[model samples]
Target chain A: MKFKNNTVTLDATDLKILEALQKDARQTYTAIGKSLGMAHSTVYDRIKRMERQGIIKKYTTVIDAEKAGAKIITAIMTVFTDPKESENVAKKLCLAPQILEVYTSLSEELLIIAKVIAENQEGLHEFIACSVAPLPGVLRIRTSMITKKFKETQFSIADNSKVNIYKRNP
Target chain B: MNEKMASRILRTLSREKAFYFFTSIGNYTGESAASLRTFVDKIREMNLKSLEFHFYRGDFEKWIAEVLEDKELAEQIGTFRNSSPIGESLKNELYRILVRRYSKLKSMLY
Candidate 1:
C-alpha cells in the first residue's frame, strides 16, 4: 500500500508479502513483486522498510542442519548457579557457537537449550563433557535425541487453522 | 475449556474427517515464537477459546519465562519444559466459549 512521503504503509498486501516471505525467504524480490502486482523496486523498498523496523529479520539459507554435519540437539540443561552467576553462565553458553539459543526459566531451573552441531557424536560429547559440563553451576544436564522430526518451521502468517485448535477469524 | 473438553476438541480435530489441520513448533517445519504470537492473535480475534501446541523449537522454560508478563495468554497456551508432546491436555471450557464466539468455524468444521 502507498504511504506518506513515498514511504510504504503495511496493508493486507504487505501482510501477505510478509507471510509469503517468511515461508520461503529465498523467494526473489522480483517474484514477490510479480505475485503482489507491484513494481519490483516498490517491493524491494517495502521489504527494506520492514527489515529496518525489525519485522523482517535477516534472510537465511535453510541448510539441512543434519547434512551440514551439525545436529540440532535439544538439551534442557538445569543450571544450578547462584543468582549472581546467572548472567555469567548465560553468557558462557551464548558465546559457544554450538549453542545457538539459550534462555532462563522463571523458577530456579535455568533452561539451557542448544543445537550442538559437531564433527561427530564423540566431538559433540567432548564439547558437552569438557566445555559444557565443566562449566560451574551447571547442576544437571538432560539431553534428548531428536529421534524423528515431525515438523519444524519459523513464524509465518498462513493457514494456522490446522495449527491452532482455536477457530480463527478470516 | 477444561482439560477433558480440550482433549475432546483435539481428538475431534485429529479425526480429520472433513478438515485436516496441522502445526508444530521446531526449527525445521513448525511455528516460531513470532508465528505463535500471530496465530494466537488471529485466533483470539476470532474469539477462539481452545487451542493446543506442541512446542519444540527451543527451550519452553525460557519461552515461558520471557512472557510471564502475559500470564493470561501463557496460561491459555500452556507451556511444558522437557515434557513429551503427548502429555499436554486441552482446555475444553475455553473451547466452548470460543465456539460460541467464533461461528465461522462451524462451516469449516463440517
Candidate 2:
C-alpha cells in the first residue's frame, strides 16, 4: 500500500524484494525468486523500480575488521564551529579512514564517530595520532574500543497495515 | 587438559589483574584467550566498564595511507567507512563482567 506521506504503493512481492535486498544486496534475482516463489524477471523488475523510487540504495559486502586483523577503535568527537566552518570540517573528517560516521546534532554539536583497524597497537596508535587527531574543528574526542557486536539488520517493510497487491496482479 | 593448567590460567589472571594479565597473555595461545585477555586489559585501562566486539572490513591505516597514496581506492574506502556502528547492548555485557570482577575484589579486601 502507499505510504501516508508519499502516494507510492508497494505490494507484498515488492516488500519481499525490498526485504531480500536489505538482507543481502548482492542476492541475485534468481535467488530472490526462489525464496519468494516468483519468476526471476519479476524480481529484477521490482528491484529496478525500487531503485528508481529511491527506496533501495547501493550494495556492498560487510567485512569483519577483527577477523581481518584490523584493530577497531571508535571515538565520538565534539566540535565547536562558526557554523560556516562546519561543512569544511565535516569534509575533512569524512576523509579520515578511522572515521565511520558523522552526525550533525540539531543542538549544533558536530558528532564525529570513527572506527579503525590496525595491525598492532603501534599501528593503531599511529592511525589515531596522524589521521584523526589532526582534523580541523574537533574540540574533544571520547575514544573507546568495541569489544562485541549486538544487532545488525537491514530495513524492514512491515509498516504497512495490509498488503493485497498479489491478488490484483495474479 | 588438566585442572592444573586451567587453574593456572585463572590464578594468573586473577593475581595479575589489569596490567599483569595483558603482559601474561602475549605468550598465551588460543584465539579466544589471547584476544579476550587483550580486550580485558583495554577495558581495565580505559575504565570502559562495557564493550562489544564486531567484525568490520577495511584497515584504518591502510585506508588513510591509500587516500594519500592512491586516489581510486580512496573513494572505495570512503564508502566502506560511511557505515558501521557497534551498539550499547553489547557493550553492557562486557561492563557487567568487569563490574562483577571488581565487586569480587572489593569483597576480598573487606
Candidate 3:
C-alpha cells in the first residue's frame, strides 16, 4: 500500500498484465483481456498508464547470437587502472563497439569491468593488446571466457501478486 | 547435405509457387517472393501493418511450410509466430531469422 515518490506501483492486475506481455508482447489486447475477463479498453488504459509511469519499458525480442551469425567469444574482463585514470579508462571502454557493457567497480579491487565480444580468439587478443593495454595508467587485465550460456532472461514477472510495491506518489 | 539437396532447397519457384504477402484472404500487398533471398528482402521492407496482420494469421508459416517446403524455416517462423511480436520488433525479428536461414542455405551452394 505504501509507495515511493515517482515510482510505479503495480497492482495484481498490473502484474498479470505484465505476465501476459512477458509471454508474448504482441498478444492482442482483446485476447489478453479476454483471458483475464477484463475489458480490452481497461487493459489498454493500464498498459498506457504503465508506459507513462515507465514500469513497462520498451518491448523487445532476444536474438540467438550464434544463429544470427554473431558467433563470438564473450569475455568478462577485469582491468586494473590507476585511480586517477579509472574514469578515463571506463570511458574509453564504452566507445569500443566490441565492448557491449562497461562498469566501474570498487569490489575487492578498484577495477573497470567490461563485457567484450570478439569474432575469434585473435580478434579478442588484438583488442586487449592494441586497444586496452595501450591506454595510459593501464594495469594488468584478467579475462574469464564464457564457455556456454545455459539461460538468459529479462525481468521476471512472476508469482508475486502479493508482493507489495510502492506506487508513483506525485 | 548433397548438392542436389541444397539445390532443391535453394531452387527458384514458378509464379504459382511463389509466396505472396497478403493483408487478408483476398487482399495482396503486391509483393511475392520466389526464393529465400527475396523473401528476406520482402519481409524487411513490407508494410508493418500488413506484416502484422499476416503474421497473426499464420500466413507466413503456411506459405513457407507448404510452398517453399522448407520444414526448418517453416518451423522456425512457426515457433516465432507462436511466441509473437508486433510492430518494429516483429519486423526486425522476422528479418533476422529469414536472413540467417538464407545465409546458411546460400553457404551450402558453395
Candidate 4:
C-alpha cells in the first residue's frame, strides 16, 4: 500500500510490473501486460505514476568498464579539509569522467571511496597524478586495482521488501 | 586421446582455476547460452577445488577485452556494438571459441 514516510501508494500489480521492468527494461508494454495479465494501458499508467512519485528513477544501461577496454580501479582517499570544503570536493570529484562511484565513509576521518577507470596502468597513473592528486584538500590517496570481478548487479525490485506487496495481499 | 594429452588438459584446467563468462539476458535462448551452460556443467562435474565461475552481465566485446584479454578480438566484436541485444552475436562468437577449447579438453579426458 503506502510507504510509511511518503504518500506513494503501490499495490501488488505495481510491484510485479516494477520487477518485470527491472529484469528487462526493453520489454514492450504489451509484452509486460501479457505476462502480468493486465492491459498495456494499465501497465503504462502504473509506470507513469511510479515515475511521478519518484519510486522509479531514471532508466540506465550498466556497462562493464573492464570489458569496455578500461581498467577498473578503486581508491580510498582521506581528505583533510574544512567541513565546508567537503561538499565542494565531492562536487569536483563527481565531475571527472574517469570517476564512476563516490561515497563518504562514516569514519572520523573524512574518507572518500571512489571507483575509477583507465585504459591501462600508465593511464591510471596519469589520472591519479593529474585529476585526483591535484584536487584541493585531498590529503592522502590509497588505490587498488581490480584484477577480477565476481558479481555485479543493479538494484533488484525482486529483492526489495517494500515491493513485496503481493505477499501481503495474497 | 592419449593419456599425455588428457593429463595436459587436466593440468591446464587445474592452473586456470577461475573463469568469468560475460553475457546478457538478451541471448538467453541462443546456442552460445547452451554452450556456456554445458561448459559450466562440465566444470562442476570435475569437482575441482578453488575453481570459480562468474557470469558477468555485458556483451561479447566487453568479455573479450576484459576476460579473454584479446584487444584484436575486442575490436572485431566492437563492429557489432550497435546491434540491438548485442549479446546474441557475442554469445555465438564466444561459443565458437569456448567449444574449441572445451572440445580439446573433453577429448583428452574421454
Q: Model 2: how far is A26 from its true place, Å?
A: 5.2
Instruction: Give RMSD (Å) of candidate 2 vs. truth.
Output: 20.2
Point to the candidate with the largest lDDT: 3
On residues A1-170, what C-alpha lDDT tens digit does candidate 4 reach at each position? 47767566568788899999998889999999999999999999988889988889988897865588654554333334445556777788899887888787656777667777766655665565446554556554566666666766766768765666335332
Model 2, A1-170: lDDT tens digits are 35657745677678777767766778799999999899999998878887787777666678876698765444333444436666776777678665666666546454544444455555554554444444444344444544566864544554332463233221
> DockQ (Cα-based) per candidate?
0.01, 0.02, 0.01, 0.01
A best-first ranking of the candidates according to their TM-score comes to 3, 4, 1, 2
Model 3 gets an lDDT of 0.77
**lDDT of residue B65 for candidate 2:** 30
| C-alpha positional error of residue B64 in candidate 2 after TM-score superposition, expressed in Å | 26
In candidate 3, position B9 carries an lDDT of: 70
> Cα lDDT of model 1 overall?
0.48
Question: TM-score (chain A) of candidate 3?
Answer: 0.80
Return the TM-score for candidate 4, rounded to 2 decimals: 0.52
Q: Would candidate 3 be rated incorrect, acceptable, medium or high by CAPRI criteria?
A: incorrect
Better of 1 and 3 by lDDT: 3
lDDT (10s digit) by residue, model 1, range A1-170: 44558654567666767867977778898999888788889778878888887667787788886798754554333444456666777889888887766777656455555555555444554465446554555544544445577777765566653586323333
- Model 2 chain A scores worst on lDDT over the 10 consecutive residues at A161-170
Stretches off by above 4 angstroms in model 4 are: A1-9, A64-82, A162-170, B1-110
Question: TM for chain B in all models?
Answer: 0.25, 0.27, 0.90, 0.31
Worst 10 residues of 4 chain A by lDDT: A73-82
List the TM-score for candidate 4's chain B.
0.31
Can you write out model 3's per-residue Cα lDDT over A122-153, one digit (the tens) per residue?
Answer: 57755775577656666657777788888766
